[model samples]
Target: MAVFNPFLPSYQADPYPAYAALRAEDPVHFSAAIQAWVLTTHEDCERVLRDQETFSSSSDTASGQLATVLQQQRREFPLGEVPTVLNSDPPVHTRLRTLLNRAFTPRAIEGLRPHIEDIAASLLADAGRTGGRFDAVTGFAQPLPIIVIAELLGVPPEDRDQLKEWSTAIANTTNVLNTEDALAAARQATMELIAYMDEIVAQRRAAPGADIMTALVQAEEGGERLSHDELLAFSILLLLAGHETTTNLIGNGLLALTEHPEAAAGLRAEPDLLPSAVEEFLRYDSSVQGAVRFARETVEVRGRTIERGSTLLLLLGAANRDPAQFPEPDALDVARSPNRHLSFGRGVHFCLGAPLARLEGDVAFRALLDRFTELRVAEGGAERSGTLVLRGMGKLVLEV
Candidate 1:
């Protein structure tokens, strides 16, 4: 009877062992700690993701205690349960996603490569100037994505630090086991961020620019456009999704490389392996550990019946490492091909920022390897974030 306690420090530091145990003994089991049925198998998670009709993403569709808790939390949100791309299902999600997709065009993403490379080089240069040792989280990983996203969103450079603070506060509330204090801080941050974004949105509306923010503001399809509240929700979501996840990706990837010198050496020798290396990093330790979905109807899985409206915690990290789907799943192989990881999710709700994230990672890792000959973890190891939903290091000191 293995229990899932994600809040435990040990689990936060390393949850693969727990995921392995669950996948071996009970692939689909209910966990009282988070009050959700945890799905660990890659097949099970993939099925749920693909069958969005049966499993809804909206907090509104969520029933049982999960719905009750979400309702209470919504009351505190500045936008008040407005269905965004992340939480909504079907037609509403379809509409929102279509408009948002305008800003993330393939051309738009690829065009940012030069800018991303510049940002990475500048950050790494600053870190190098720090005389060989620096906190990678702050000096490199954290700021790289923040600056890139801020520029993408048309946010001014002076306001990025404040935005990062607000985004971090909001990210803390993503954890299922979040405390009252965290929720309170997140509420405050949300309110302030909305106010700040309202001004930017207004500016974009008045005068468009060559940026994603402008694209979002002007996005129209079949006589439908994002409402004011929807805009706010999207802007907030972009900041979180764009900044937080990639920050963790870079941090976690660097940590992994340092741990596996052979992999790092191989990557340096064959830089074309970068694309695959980034994918391997994503699979090895995903930035987003899990996602929540509610069963829209009674469903049978692994001889277990999940009642209608029951919440399911799809463990993406676990699924990535599931032995059945990935051969030698735990091994770090940068050149592994046909890698289909759930890090960007699947179906309608797949991460829209995937292109940008992948681009950023490619540039960041390349820049690091090109500039610094050696990258070693500092005296103390990574300080892992407490949030269970998102996995990342808050601080990772590095010696180059």
Candidate 2:
């Protein structure tokens, strides 16, 4: 029988096989260990994402282990409990998204391309100074996105490192099954981050700047502005979600290219394929492996009756690989056309930072390939992130 245990080391190493097993035998299976129903097929996952009324995004609707974690988080760190776009639905979510859209417009994002390209070049140049060997996670992947997001949020460049540290702490608690120690650390980090954001927001209000923070502070839709708590929550969410996923994308994409040299070579040969390659990278190994939702009412999925209030784990990584959606899902094809992968998810909560991430990935990959003639994994194996939901590398040494 196939098991849906995400905590297993083997599963962390490569979850696609296990995902494949569950999709074939039991697409909608409940795992007692995690205390949630796991959905593997693309269609079923899409159905849940699209029908927000039936599957809620709010912690108030969560059940079982998810509720326990959320309750404790709220009690211990109320700052993290605010109804931001990530955890809110409909009216609340609609308002938050609308305001955010005004601040994070496409033109604003597009304007950052030249800056992103410069940052990627600078990071690679610094790597070259390190005698041809460096930990890509720290030296290249992590800093590139951190710098970009920090500048966008009006954070000074020097404090980017500290911001990343706090962000990582908060992200550790993404999975409800995390250790108490992890939760405690995350709580402390949440407090510190909120305090810092409060100060920044005040500064932005006092003297507006050409940054996302200033735009957010000034943004108004129908004469409705974000409340103080809403502002803080949205800022915190942006900082956390903005860079972390893209960091993982770059790291994971690099690893994928390293494992499949032919794809890397192909990209180097035909530079126009970078965007398509980035899409494949997102599909093959997503930064966010899955997302959490609550069953608002009893719903039948693939003959399985999911009771109201039950927590559901929509396995996005698995869904992206479902043969019903993508042919030969296991194989990595850079030029896969009509690739409608759910790496950024679907429906109302689809990733807001998708374009930014794609741009960063394109720039990072192009810069790396153009600068270095060869790329190889170092002797020591890479270290994967502790959390299951936000999957990525902790440390991956590379030689160029």
Candidate 3:
């Protein structure tokens, strides 16, 4: 049996080869490192994500690897007490998503296109004056989504820096490995985040604004509205989900483009292909790499029986690169059509910010190509975020 330890620094640096090996030989293998079943194939991953009955999405205390990983911290984490979209199932999940969609409707998100364009253009213009080089993660990619989401949520300009600081801490909690220090930081961050959101929600109630936060706070349907706990949870979810993944999307997508100059040249020549190029970048190197699910009942997959209450880690990265699902999956093809990659995941829990992420990606690539004739990776390579569950560049310096 081949070992699948994604936590190792070497594997974190380049996980594709290991993912490829798993997809080929051990599509559904047990990873002693994570102490859970690792699902690599696209089909398996889709089944696990969609079949919420057999596999639960309950983030905490679901008898899965997550529950086991942070047995102590979760019990005290303030966010754990409230039911959010990420941790809820069925009626609860359906209700939270409904209230959320009221504020995050397609039209509502699309309305921010002009705003996204402005932010992207401004960031790139500022980077341009910096002697033809800038750290994409800090200067552009990281701030883009934070500013956009802060605007959407009606967070005041003066408060966004603090919000980003809290969000960064919250996002850091879910490291690939559930270490004591990480969990401790996560617990503290969760408590602080919930409290901060509570304050903002209170303010929104008193003085409503034309923002998602206000809409979410006041959203009502059939006499059903978000309770205090629900509002706080949803706020936390929006704050974290809105920026974190999109930041990675831009960073990873730009980095991938720099690596594959042919694709970059094609996009530069035919900018219309930027949309497809973003999809390929997602498939080739996704932002959120894997997800965890708890088994609701004894389930047999790939001739192996996983007992009920067991933890399962679905490797979305590996699944995206499965040769069976994607031909020449290793190669980066900007114009690959029928690109049904599971980057935003599948089923109900599919990313709500997906539309916004796509819009942002389109804006970002255009801004980069339009501003600079030539973009090259800096000599120091990348200081990748020290986590496999979330593949992102912490410092992606680029030279033009």
Candidate 4:
């Protein structure tokens, strides 16, 4: 009998080997600790994502104790009645996604490129002002997304720090509910976040601005628009989804570059490779590593039967390194084309902030490489974010 416990120090430092073994030996094994069936291979993961009918994103499909847990989550938090885009299924998911697409249009994201560059450049300049040594997490990666999302939502500049605080507290609560302190903090954050967004919604109504938040407030489809609670939930979701994950992406990408000098130098020498490099970073160390879905009904998969209401942990990190999907899958190849990793996941639930995240990564990496010739991990090593669902560092101190 084999198992994958992400809590193990060895796995936290590097889960690739364990993931490889699982892909080869136990593609569809059960982890007793999580009490869920784990899917490791690229094929199985993709199959589960594509066939949402059998595996629903909505927890309403769950039964028994799983349903109890879902109820407990809502009881503990103030997320309102409507589901955010992340944990929903069609036609609820379909409607929310349709409206979301209008708000996160390609044209809007493309326009942010220049602004992203400016933000990245300014941060790098501040870091390099008194020579090159800064906490990448606090100095650059974290604030970039916070500032970007705040501006996009028409949030005042004075409130970015508070927004970051609430977003971080909420992100910490994902896939973790056993602890009293964590859940309490999450509930507090949720209440505050909702209240804060509620104020923004009111302000927008009074005098709409030229920003995405205003657009979402006024967006109508067949005379359909978000209600009071839906508007607040959407704003909170957009802030958390856009802010926390991309910060991790930037931090993780920089950490990868620090560890792999040759690849970093290559990226600097050939800046054209930044886009491909971003994908490789995502594959190598995804920000959101895995997601949970409830089994709509009992279904046999890869010779095992998953019962209804059973939790399914789709290992996006493991699937990205499945040898069947890539040559030398463990190796970080910035130039690896045809790279289709499930970091942001697949299907209708794919990350809406993917383009914005990629743009931020491209800008951040190029600016870092161009500004500093030498880059290495600083003292105290790196802290692994202790969450089952999201894989990222707490802080990445760098010497340049």
Candidate 5:
């Protein structure tokens, strides 16, 4: 049977039909093209994520387009050498995650709330002056996250544009480009970012400051701490993951509101509903579409037995819409109560930046709604990012 390529232009234009079809007929069907089983049900997705012992996160076992991308670039960006917390399992993942958690503590992120508000207000002010018409994605959504992430990483304000370009290149290199070139670009970007971070680390080492980087350099648990390379890798991961995902969240949320005016109006009437509205946005159009896992042992999920070493691709986007877990699964209801969406993921690998992301989303949407009295899609249908794993609009034009 022909396999479904969700990244294709046709699917990007309207993926719900395909998702519904998969859920009904092939929730756990194997694809020869991708050489992996695609899980589309909510229960199965939760099982794969919760039972990490049975399902590994090794990219080698990640089949489909994502696997092809990794396979092509594995040599330069060998999955093993990189110390990203997202790819590890068990004790190692626990340790790395614990160390990183200190940087994003409640107090730490809360401290930046004032700064975040300032950024949002300034961005909106600029947008208002531009005659109440702008590319929401470029003018507002993209810049807010990038600026906040740059500030958090101790990146000098002068070099933020360079950081943004490098980060965008790294994200883009994941799709279409040859693995070698993509890997080279990633490595080059990593090196440049690390060189810049090295200066911050060195300065912090000399004179401790209030930044997370400074705190991390001095942090130690039982005399065990991050090595130089580990620090560099973790820092880069924070910079990329922190902004990129939230940027999409804001863009996708704005686009969704514009497309569904009723839902947008409901939010405008009751600003208190912003939290649930954000959840609906995550469920309706998740930022990260799916995640990869390797079957550590033979496991039966949703009536299918997955063989040891076989790869499993859990479609979070599909799971969010599964009727078993959600009532009125296809509707965009701003007052969606009991909205337990998996946009930030689940289990031990749950997004450390969730709090910050939520805060940003809440502040951003409220600001956008208050500033613009009349908001509608201005130009072009939403263009999704080419990457298969990360689901988001590439651009969304809005007029107010």
Candidate 6:
């Protein structure tokens, strides 16, 4: 199969066609541009995500733009380490994940439901007062997650803007700034966040609070507390993963609802379906489009052999739309039950914040419907961000 740049703007706008072609003609196709084998089939993607031994997530060979960024600032980037929980295989991954799991306990997330609902309600009320025209991304999607993360991290509400600026500087795809500048900004952000966390940790050490940060500060494993670097990395991961992915979830789900009126009407009529609708939204258009993994040894997938040390890009978006896995794969079904999607990932490295994300999504969509009686796409089509790994709309203007 001929290799092409999947990061091109054209591909970003509509990757389904390319993904369909790949899944049909070359499910395990290798691309020189990305220097990784593309896994497009649903079964293959699940297999790769589940079997971490054969396919490593250590970021040993992440090429293209992300590779450049990681190589330049290996020590600073939490993900640069050989294997953080999100990027590690078992044992180490298991240990790290186990240590962090207490923070995201089901009771903790459930306890947060009221707070999340309140935040969504307040934001929706503001949107309603604006006479119906609002940028959904800015008005609702962005603020809800930012506030939730800020509250979770115990960061001052006033400082939330700076936190977002830092995250955007590092993660924004439209920023044409040089890699050095981006790295510098990321390093500065890391230091600032760490400094803030250090103070919070000190306070927590002196007198623990009920927040997750305090819990983490006081957490003990085999009579061991988390190292400073580990704590910092874990905090950064939680903030980034917590906000970035959920931001896209809200944005993408709203976009889907606006585009599909019948589905939206169904959701409005039956609010109970919102949870399943969120799941279907995840399946139809996932936030994390693909995850990178390194091949531990020679592995044959979809009739193609991937060499050891090579990178593999498991196309989550493609897998979600695989005709073999989903009936009427392209259509958006709000009531699609038994939706087993890899949007939150799978296996040992599954997303720890999945429960929180679901809760947030359900609250967000329900509040959105309740607040806006008439909703339509203010802008007909979505402008997508250019990042290959994360896929989301750049802006989604909606007339509520």
Pairs clashing in candidate 2? none
Q: How big is the positional error of residue 161 in model 1, measured in Å on the Cα after superposition?
A: 0.4
Q: After superposition, how far is residue 349 of candidate 6 from its true place, in Å?
A: 0.6
Q: TM-score for model 6?
A: 0.93
Write one digit per residue (lDDT tens) for candidate 3, span 1-400. 5679976777878898888788778888988777788999999999999998888877454564555654544457675667777776888888878877888788887888888899888888777465767888898888888898888777778888888887877777677565677667766777777777778788889999888889988888878999988887777777787788888888888888788888889998898998998898889889888888888889999999998888888999999998888889989999999798998888888888788889888998898888767778889957787464778888988886
Provide the lDDT at 396 for model 1. Answer: 88
Q: Which candidate do you rate higher for lDDT, 4 or 5? A: 4
Q: Candidate 1: give the clashing pairs.
A: none
lDDT (10s digit) by residue, model 2, range 157-187: 8788889999988887786567888888988
Q: Quick one: ranking by lDDT, best first? A: 1, 2, 4, 3, 6, 5
What's the CA error at residue 197 for candidate 5, in Å? 2.3
Clashes of each: 0, 0, 0, 0, 0, 0
Q: lDDT by residue for model 4 over 1-400, one digit each (tens)?
A: 5578876778767777888788888899888766778899889999899888889887765654434566677666786457878888889888888877777888888898898889888877768357556778888888898999999988889999998988878776665434778777878988988887888889999999988888888887887887788788888888887887888888888888888899988987889999999999999888877877889999999999989887888889999888889888888899998998998888888888888888888888888888778887778856766467676778787776
Question: C-alpha displacement of 119 in model 2, angstroms?
Answer: 0.8
lDDT of 1 by residue, 107-209 (tens): 9999999988988888877674656778888988999999988987889999999999999999877776878998899999999999999999999999999
Runs off by more than 4 Å, candidate 3? 59-65
Measured by lDDT, the strongest candidate is 1
Which ranges in model 4 have alpha carbons more than 4 Å from their true place? 63-68, 128-132, 175-178
lDDT of 6 by residue, 296-392 (tens): 8877876688777777788999999999989999999999877988898888878899999999999999988888877787755356663676767
**TM-score, structure 2 vs. true:** 0.97
